[model samples]
Target: MSIEFYEEYIESNKAIIYKICRAYTHSKLEFDDYFQEVCLQLWKSKEAYNHQSKLSTWVYRVTLNTCLSIIKSEKREVDTVEINESFDHHSDLEDTEAQERLNTLYMGIRQLKKADRAIIVLYLEDKSYQEIAEIIGISMSNVGVKINRIKQQLKDSIVWKSLI
Candidate 1:
């Protein structure tokens, strides 16, 4: 791929790239580092694009695999956090409530195994079962099963939290 093509690709898909970075890294520093590494890997692996899947799917596969490899090599501790993204347009109370719920949901997700976390993140991003299976190298049926189980686990966690 030409440099122009790679630059344009990164520009257009920056959000997905950043989302993967955020999902994997706990701190701002780590996020920055991971984002750079992902970009570098994408550039270096440009020749590996086989057109078997959409470019976005290929990007996801690359990003997730890169993150998994880094995590394994570093053996870094996973940090569980309450996610807080600001929406200034919303009323203060509504924003607070939304943020809290999102945080709780993310916290529950953080409890899952790494593989489950990757699957659920793709599902949340509205990727189809087939696409998710392709990216994660799992069967479509397995994707459905894992998503159902993960949803139930999240619900159970919420209920358990509420009772406490």
Candidate 2:
């Protein structure tokens, strides 16, 4: 890679890789291993990185694949943090609420099948349905249909659990 391109990747992708690592592992050791694995995967896929998809989309795809390939993750410790362009810290109370929501979100995501989780993560991160469909190799209408079905399934499962 050119110096400029390498620097660009460093500037934009460092934190993304870290977040993916934390999302996929619970311990510092596992985080280090997975972080390296993700970086290696990203490096290997550099030639295949098409500009047609957003950079973050590509990163998420690689990260998910790496996580799925890992054999020993029984517990996941990551939160669904929303990144805003304005960089608002929000209040500590809001952070607590966000963390709670994130826990719920992760639990809900864990309830999904591999395919469903991909769509949900992308949707939660505010990707356009068209972009998400393209990234996941599905049709646009299928994306909406899958999301609706997953939402219903989640609702039903939650309601059923309360009865127990």
Candidate 3:
């Protein structure tokens, strides 16, 4: 693909890309790094997309796979880089209860297994089970079962957080 086309694609999918980065990265610097890498990988793998699914689904697959690969690599860093900018950009900051739930939910998600995290991210994005299965390369029935388990695990984690 041409540079202009790739740039346009990234611009159009910025929100989705950023959301994946935020979910998988622990720090702003890491998020930025992941975002750059995903964009590069997306462009590199553009030809592999055979139109078997929606373009967004292909993007999600690439993004998630890139993240998982980064996390699994031996050269991955353990120490997080601190960012100068605060990441408290919640849109509905005035709603305290909702904010707390959102925070707790993110905390719970961070503790999940990598594959489970991918599944839940898609679930939260309101992707259909079949779409998620396609992105994650799982069967639809397995996606349903895993989602149920992951949801229960998230609830347990959130409840535990409330106690503390």
- Number of clashes in every candidate structure? 0, 0, 0
Q: What value of lDDT does candidate 3 attain over all alpha carbons?
A: 0.77
Candidate 1 has an lDDT of: 0.77
RMSD for all candidates, in order, please.
4.3, 7.3, 4.0
User: What tens-digit string does per-residue lDDT give for candidate 2 at 1-164?
Assistant: 46665565534766555544444444467667877787777777887987886787788778768877763354432333222111111113357667655544445555566667667767766778898887788999999999888788667755664476
Query: Which TM-score value belongs to model 3?
Result: 0.81
What is the full ranking by TM-score, best candidate first?
Answer: 3, 1, 2
| Number of the top-ranking candidate, with TM-score as the measure | 3
Model 3, C-alpha of 60: deviation from truth (Å): 0.5
Query: How many clashing pairs does model 3 include?
Result: 0
Query: TM-score: which is higher, 2 or 3?
Result: 3
lDDT of 2 at 15: 56
Segments in model 3 whose C-alpha atoms lie over 4 Å from true places = 1-8, 75-97
Worst 10 residues of 1 by lDDT: 83-92
lDDT of 3 by residue, 4-55 (tens): 7676667776766776766677667777888889988988888898987788
Runs with alpha carbons beyond 4 Å of true place in candidate 2: 1-7, 10-32, 71-94, 157-164
lDDT of 1 by residue, 1-164 (tens): 57696676677677677667666665567777887888888999878999888988888888888888898899865644443442222123456778777656666776677888889889988999999998999999999999999999889987887797
Pairs clashing within candidate 3? none
How close to the true structure is residue 9 of candidate 2, measured as C-alpha lDDT?
A: 52
